[model samples]
Target: MATITKRSEDYSKWYQELVIKAGLAEPSEVRGCMIIKPYGFAIWEKIQAYLDRRFKETGHQNAYFPIFIPKSFFSKEAEHVEGFAKEAAVVTHYRLKNSPDGKGVIVDPEAKLEEEYIVRPTSETIIWNTYRNWIQSYRDLPILINQWANVVRWEMRTRLFLRTSEFLWQEGHTAHETADEALAEARQMLEVYREFAENLLAVPVIAGSKSPSERFAGAIETFTIEGLMQDGKALQMGTSHFLGQNFAKAFDVKFLNRDGKQEYVWATSWGVSTRLIGALIMTHSDDNGLVLPPKIAPLQVVIVPIYKKTEQLEQITEYVQPIIKGLRAKGITVKFDNDNNKTPGWKFNEYELKGVPVRIAVGPRDMKGRSVEIARRDTLEKKTYPVDNVAEIVDNLLVQIQNDIFQRALDYRQKHTYYVDSWEEFKQRIEEGGFVLAHWDGTDETEARIKELTKATIRVLPVEEIKEQGKDLLTGKLSERRVVFARAY
Candidate 1:
């Protein structure tokens, strides 16, 4: 029943409308927060299940950490504190009491604590502090732990899932005996994120390292998966950081070696958040509505029955039972919409808008011919199929739809990406909006200046490492390789 604004007319408005009209999420009363509806949570659950399995497969264990961190804990690391200080939300008092003027509640003066607590913008400080107590010997060398939690940052401007003050995410913090092991762990997780983004979410990404200016605070190196959206803006899908000995030294986390020598532990941290939902929407969705890949869609197949009489409806259900059972046996999610309140025409549009990968409609004519009407959301194409082997047909169709959508996104990214060598060309290409590969002098000052001039920052330095003779776009100095530059979300 809901219609979305045309994406060609206004991309930002189209996205916001699709998110709400599809029943995914809505703006909450609390500023910079969102209330994820059941449909959206289901999609998130699928994402969690897949990623959690991947984490455990790679030798990571789930763990919990405190939400409230002691304010002084941040001062242990200067860069970490500086990175999040502006956005950190602090709790100054513990209790609330009735206002003396009798309007509402106020902070209880008598219940104030001596120390303030910072709502964790990240768990590194507290987690490392706890690690100091947990690791004391070489036998406890590698600690690979992950936590799924909600974090808050007081963002001045926010969008539903893209830049919320509070959002759900999973962060992996690992400790190793040597710097090599820590670096390898970080790279391994980056691969995990890359595969997850391309195969599961069906969103193609560029796997690379962040520039020094864009690196995670307190990290020696940061690896990231960046995806280009339909609007030509790049979105960082996930990041893995090689933390070196920074946190270990700050929190005094040391383990005794086999030779009885004390040394600081090496560390790594990585995370991906609900911002991925926004990426998914922007990558494959269209003017019709949200277009979901079968691998992660909450509802893969929806069957709508068409009938005029009660007996006709009963006949359709009887025929669909085996097909539904067969589909379910194959681990396919299907919903049978027999609700008489809504007509079949209305149901068809509803599932299309919701981005159900496949839709099947069973009616009297199809029943006479032992066939059904089938529609594929990705292609927006419809066909008639014999009901004899509907389950197998639908199964194969789901797989095809998933791969098709991924290829579509990959093609879009390829079309938008550009390689430019001249300053004038770089400026024009950037304004056109897409990923630009250009030479840089590998200096933070040049990086900062380019962003100031064009508002485009380095998105990543490719893992494959581009080696070529070139000149910087702005300074015209000799450069070793070209880096990816784009305006990002």
Candidate 2:
């Protein structure tokens, strides 16, 4: 029984404690790694199940790619190599040998490979290289493949599930015959991520494209979903990138068109990492603990028997058996906590910390009245309902809880978003850390300068630009419309 700190007192520490205390995850001995516990993995499994189904429905196939890439592949894309080189974890030696001094082992020079390999930060280089061999004709134009695997990025600072050195994610690599098709695929996946984040995770996000300076390393354009955390900071929940023909040209991934002419393939890659779990926790969780959305909660409803004596405990269990059966038959995941050592109040707090959406208390008094006490995790509101129609009430309340959480986040985003027409106002509003809508000169230098000064980058540019007359906030030049700017993750 660890004593959890109140979120209001210290939000960051509260998050650190909640994740470990609730059996979610823990920091590993490896400097920037985490061990996700069973409960945490269960949540990830649910996310994977839903996203996998959605990907399959969208004509995508699951495939595995090699984890290690020949170092030369990265250098083929100049910008990409420059962007990722600093964070790459390179594999220099293949085997180890005992030293002459007999103290420990040393790198075996005799076993060195002809080429070094780099652990992938992203799969673009390797996937594109593979595509060159697989694609040859117009029939093989659209190669939609997704891979579920772990990627390593050597970060100086890391947090559990947020910025780990190694984390699990699903990366989608698709090749198309035309740039238009590739762009459409990227946007479509962005929408899928937005829907999942909003509906399943109960975290509202703004969907849009990244600016030139903020786009992915080799991507011609990048789309993103940004969510606001309870601490007033922004988190980039997911990203989809349109690769144009850059990757195809680098890897010589060409195919014969219907007219019998060789043409390079258009490519797109997108992914949402374990960082989403971090966003979900920060968005809807409270001082009590995490409040998971019912759609993805491992246990949607928990039934705790409250009784004074052994005889009453049996009666409470007897009364709950049929209700549990009814709920489980309707596809609800329910858990009956029958541990005799812990009292009902203790069990209640435990489940609340674990974020079970709904908790039902069945006691001797409630059994006498043919009723049960139901508590909603989101609002901490409790209501006594008759057992005769308990199943229906539980089902309806679950749906309501999901909707309410999403609406609340939406409302917060609306309230915090600010529109600025001048540089002074932009600087002033950004200090407080929220979305600032401002115009730009549409240059990489201007975007970079803004970031250097305020640490706020262009989070996204709308697909359809808003028609408004304004000046560039930094450059003092006239502009057409404003793009979204924020100090992002």
Candidate 3:
């Protein structure tokens, strides 16, 4: 009964409608929070499974940290504390009591704790504090740990998944004896994220290092993967930060070096969150509904039985039983919808809206002819195939869809990307929206002035930058190469 708003008509409205109408997520009773529905959570679980396996294979271990930190812990790192000071959710009292009017509970002033606690915006402070105790010598030098948890930022403006106050994510905090190793770990995880985004999510991304102005607080360098959305805006898909001993020094976490000298541990922290769901939606979903990559889709192939009466339906079901068994045997997530309450047409529409990669329709004519009709969600194209080895066909088709969509996204990004050499051209392209590649004077003042005139910020400095002599677009100052700039989500 829900109608989808066209993306061209209203992109923001279309996103909210598709998220709720398609049973993905909804806003929660708590302000700025969301409840990720089962279908949505399934996608998140797939993301977690892929990343977790990769982390373990790369020698990272799973660990848990406390959700609340003593307020004093945040002050250890000056820049880190200042960065999150405005968003920290503080807990001042420990207990509550009935109000005088007997309406609701109120915080009991008498039960106030000696110190306040901060709900974690990020776990860098608390994790480093604990690391100080666990580490002693060179043997404990490299500690690679990741935790699956929720964080709070108390955002003023909130969307379903993009800027929610509370969201689920996995944060990786690691320590190494040397800066080179820590930097390598940071770059390695960024590569992991780029692979997951492009291959599994079918969203092409640009992986690079962040500018000083855009780098994470207290980090020496920040690596990121930015995805270009359908609306021509960039979404930061993931980030990895090289902390460079800022956290280690803050928490006094020191280890005896190989030469028996006490030195601070080099650290790194990287994470991706539910905001990725928003990026996925913006990158691929159409006006009709969500279009998920087959690799991560919860329901890959759906079998809908079509018939006139009970006996005809029975025949269709029996005929399709072997196909179902075959697909399941091949480890394809599939469903056979034979419910009488919904018409075959209704089921088809529902699956399309839910973004099922492939839909197999079995009817009397098709059954008699020993063939089935398959509909692909990506192209909205249908093909008839003989029932012989249909499971193998669907499996191969799913792979094709995944690769095709990623290529399509990659092509779109290439087309939208602009190379502007002059100031006027840069302004015009920034307004039109896409990545604008231009030179900067390499000064924070120039960057801030450019942002004041145009909302776009430097998205990333490409890791493999081509050294072409150029002048700053605004100030005409000397520059080595161009950096990517865009207005991001």
Clashing pairs in 2: none
Residue-level error in angstroms, candidate 1, position 454: 1.1
Q: What C-alpha lDDT values do all the predictions have?
A: 0.94, 0.91, 0.93
For model 3, residues 375-446, the per-residue Cα lDDT tens digits are: 999999999999988999999999999998888889989999998999999999999889998999899999
Candidate 2 structure quality by residue, lDDT tens digits, 1-489: 756889879988999999998889999999999999999999999999999999998999999999999999999998999989999998888899999899999999888878999999999999999999999998987999999999999999998888999999999999998899999999999999999999899898888888777789999999999898877678999999999999999999999988999999999999999998899898998878889999989999999998888999898889998899989888999999999999988999999999999999999889989999999999999999999878889999999999999999888888888988877888888888788888898888999999899988888776667768888987888888888888776
lDDT of 3 at 420: 92
lDDT (10s digit) by residue, model 1, range 1-489 = 588899889989999999999999999999999999999998899899999999999999999999999999999999999999999999899999999999999999998879999999999999999999999998997999999999999999998789999999999999999999999999999999999999999999999999999999899999999999999999999999999999999999999988899999999999999989999999999988889999999999999999999999999999899989999999999999899999988888888888999999999999999999999998889999999889999999999998999999999989989989889899888898899999999999999999999999999999987899899988889999989999998
TM-score computed on alpha carbons, candidate 3: 0.99
Better of 1 and 3 by lDDT: 1
RMSD values for the candidates in order, in angstroms, are 0.9, 1.5, 0.9
TM-score of each: 0.99, 0.97, 0.99
Residue 207 in candidate 2 has what lDDT? Answer: 88
> Which regions of candidate 2 fall more than 4 Å away from where they truly are?
98-106
Q: After superposition, how far is residue 353 of candidate 3 from its true place, in Å?
A: 1.2
